[model samples]
Target: MKLSELGEIGFLKKIEASLPLSDKSVLLGIGDDAAAVRVSRGKTLLSTTDLLTEGIHFDLKYISFYQLGAKALLVNISDIAAMGGIPRYALIVIAVPDNIKVAELNELYRGIKKTASSYKVSIIGGDTSGSKNSLTINITLLGEAKQGNIVSRGGARPGDKIFVTGTLGDSSAGLELLKKGKRSGYLIQRHLLPAPRVKEGVFLSKNRLAASMIDVSDGLATDLNHICEQSKVGAIIYEDKIPLSKELKKAKLKKSPLNYALSGGEDYELLFTVKASYIKKVYNAISKGRLSATMIGEITEMKKGMLIVDGKGQKMPLLPTGFNHFR
Candidate 1:
């Protein structure tokens, strides 16, 4: 069957099922956004890559070249964040359409360099090529974590508390507003220049806080489902507990803001779990980033099932509407 017909998640499942078992050096592979491996004594290596094609992942008419470049790097950085690793180097491959000006390309490079500098990562090497159609960017990022500090999606336990960094749905709202050509600065900037929660990730790892973790790249519902599936657990999220920005709350909309908060993508925040004993510390540790972590739910045994409670105290199954990638 064709990929379009199969859909992104279905296509990915087929690819994953067909792949061979990872080598011994590979600590984690295929299923997660990033892969990790044993690199050296007392240090494990983390690597992730992503691709962005013009007219697909982004549209040139609305976004600046600089923001595109920064976002390209930031997406990869977010994968590293999911693993609680310190990013060290990057390799970027670019396919440029000849019609694009050299000066504009330079501005793109400037943005990439500036973001790398802020993260203390170096652009080590990559390939450049000419594209016959449009611009394409592929980036491979490398990071490291202390051998004992690494966390994965498979570590959550029943009764663990679920927490997330910053607000949700802002980026999704930002994109919708951007498409309408509305002028909300924070929303537009979020859709354009979303920040990775690197420091927050590091704090969680170093302090031994999060039992399992993943970034909110694909939205809270989808990403949290990743953790639950890998860990063989269930969850219950409270509708009123989800952190929605004032912009999203006040905006005139067709759907509930809670729907966007649950299903919206591109927030770039961290969704993590912690044992009940350490839940208080999770809240205390997040102040380093000037944002508070919100506890939305608790992990439960798989048979208990995944659910969300609404404002009227009604309970229902929490089905994820996050994967618009296929629909």
Candidate 2:
């Protein structure tokens, strides 16, 4: 049952038999040297890739192969969502270790395939290789959007309001619980399977509701700094405005949940900016329960610098403390 016994070619043949081509956009799928895809006229292509390595990005002891596979593809889907695109195709390359069983790899592929299909994505092609000790999954996702419907991190301007979808810090809180040997908690599930806000991002972009947007993968502070750095603008956010989940709020921890909201990574929520004139429309949607988001701050002039106003109205510099692979 080991992958070594089946070998790469045999394993690939098994995978090919399991996946049927359903999307017309994918001219070719698995078993091809490279995938051939079709792009609609007047549409822009959005491509994003992510790499997850065992021990560095995840610990297999705490996660199943199925969960790991789903998370790997979902994170890449989040990137396409941030760009306001509809996911269409994927290239999944994995490095398998000798200790892994063929059944485990099948479960992993099932996870990726299920998540991909849910988002209307086709698994086009990928390469498999042998690894000494670690399992690595690298996914390249391809998406499409109308030329004018794409959002970027650099479109934010001064005086624009900052907003984020859903609650924050739940994933990090879930991670904390996992470290303590706790399982089956709500917080733990949030950490394991974070959802991408593709509908929200697309709606905002198509409606021109958001001036700029980015997913909160590297924590709010760091990802917001990405927008700031890209747009060459400064911002001021209120501490009390940062949204927190009830589950995260109830969890007892060494540090405040607010701290996790600020710098804890992998929330996969969308953080965006809306111009002042469009603020009313956004609030209207929020009031109608059509949109789930909170206005946290406003963009400021670059010279003003990034700052956070405390509950007492005290101002201080906002720093990026999110997860950095090298740091």
Model 1, range 110-219, lDDT digits (tens) per residue? Answer: 88999999899899999999999999999999999987888899899999999998889888777778788775577678888989989888888988898999988877
What are the lDDT scores of the predictions, listed in order? 0.86, 0.86
Clashing pairs in 2: none
Question: For all candidates, what are the clash counts?
Answer: 0, 0
Which candidate number maximizes TM-score? 1
How accurate locally is residue 268 in candidate 2, as Cα lDDT from 0 to 100? 93
Q: Per-residue lDDT tens digits of candidate 2, residues 1-327?
A: 877777544676689889988987654355321233556765766777788999889998888889999999999888878877788899999999999999999989999988988998999999999999899999998888777777888889999999999988889888989999998788899889889999998889889899988899889998898789778999999999999988888899877898999899899999999999999999998999878999999999998888999999999999988876533
Model 1 misses residue 20 by how many Å?
2.9
Return the TM-score for candidate 2, rounded to 2 decimals.
Answer: 0.87
Off by over 4 Å in 2: 1-41
TM, every model: 0.94, 0.87
